[model samples]
Target: MNEGKLPEWLHCNKCNAFINSLSNDSRLYILECTHIVCKKCAFARQRQSGNVLCPVCGTTCAAKCIGGDELPHDVQLFMDQSMVLSELDRLRYCVQVTLLAQLR
Candidate 1:
């Protein structure tokens, strides 16, 4: 996981959902454990403060809302906002990949 390189976005093993990569904006703030999740699943388990749990892996996280613990200034931020993916898109994308390999 080199910083500034493409983020390693992963699908959650538990719910079969794509996890989002953390963004610099998010890293600069106090949001914990950058992970992507489906909006529907995230909404269902949203915390009172509006934080969300990882839809796939069950990692607890805050929604777009920010506030929790801050990272140190010297630490280079590795998270990026660009890597988040919707559930349907993720599923569809995976299917396309599978289908393509089958054709080959």
Candidate 2:
């Protein structure tokens, strides 16, 4: 999603970067804690905490919430890049095999 398209006020709780929801329904939520973090950040945070604190309010909240999911941009980008790299590797491997067969 385009960071420019996001509203001025909306930002990721951790990095303060633009929080772009994959879908229109996504939103930042405090997991019963005081902190209010974007879903993406919260997921990452959850991994560390047995129960993560709400970035907004610091209240301890369960892993599950209404939406209860983070859509971190970095994670998405990394996953995308991973797919691209994997495809490139596959293509290169195929080319290498073809070349070896032709030489034989």
Candidate 3:
């Protein structure tokens, strides 16, 4: 972990706001499509459009707000990574099951 600093690329996929530049209490959400979004843009999109969709992939598949804005940037980064890995695992399992079924 960078401790006092986060990578430059660590940002909301939509607004491109650097995580470190965000306020200490800035909310973030992890989209099911595995995109990270800041709460401002997310909620604004929701209010304007009636739902928060991934701007990058335009997926309303799902989104998760793991916790409030009080969480530290490092913690938020960890959660984002964990969510992505979990999604990948689920997808891999689905592909495996599909391939096995097709062989039968």
lDDT of every predicted structure (CA atoms)? 0.46, 0.54, 0.64
Task: Write the residue-wise lDDT of candidate 3 on 29-80 in tens digits.
Answer: 7777888887776665563545576777876645565343444443545644
TM-score (all chains, Cα) for each model: 0.30, 0.35, 0.46
Which pairs of residues have clashing backbones in candidate 1? 19-36, 20-36, 22-79, 22-80, 23-79, 23-80, 23-81
Winner by lDDT between candidate 2 and candidate 1: 2
Which candidate, 1 or 2, would have the higher TM-score against the true structure?
A: 2
For model 2, what is the C-alpha lDDT against the true structure?
A: 0.54
lDDT of 2 by residue, 48-73 (tens): 44777555455567644222235344
Residue-pair clashes per prediction, in order, are 7, 16, 0
User: Which stretches of model 2 miss by more than 4 angstroms?
Assistant: 1-7, 20-26, 47-50, 54-59, 63-104
Model 1 — which ten-residue stretch has the worst lDDT?
Answer: 65-74
What lDDT is reached at residue 68 by model 1?
Answer: 19
The C-alpha stretches of model 3 lying farther than 4 A from their native spots are: 1-9, 21-25, 47-51, 66-104
**Candidate 1: segments with Cα more than 4 A from true spot:** 1-31, 65-104
**Candidate 2 weakest lDDT stretch, 10 residues:** 71-80
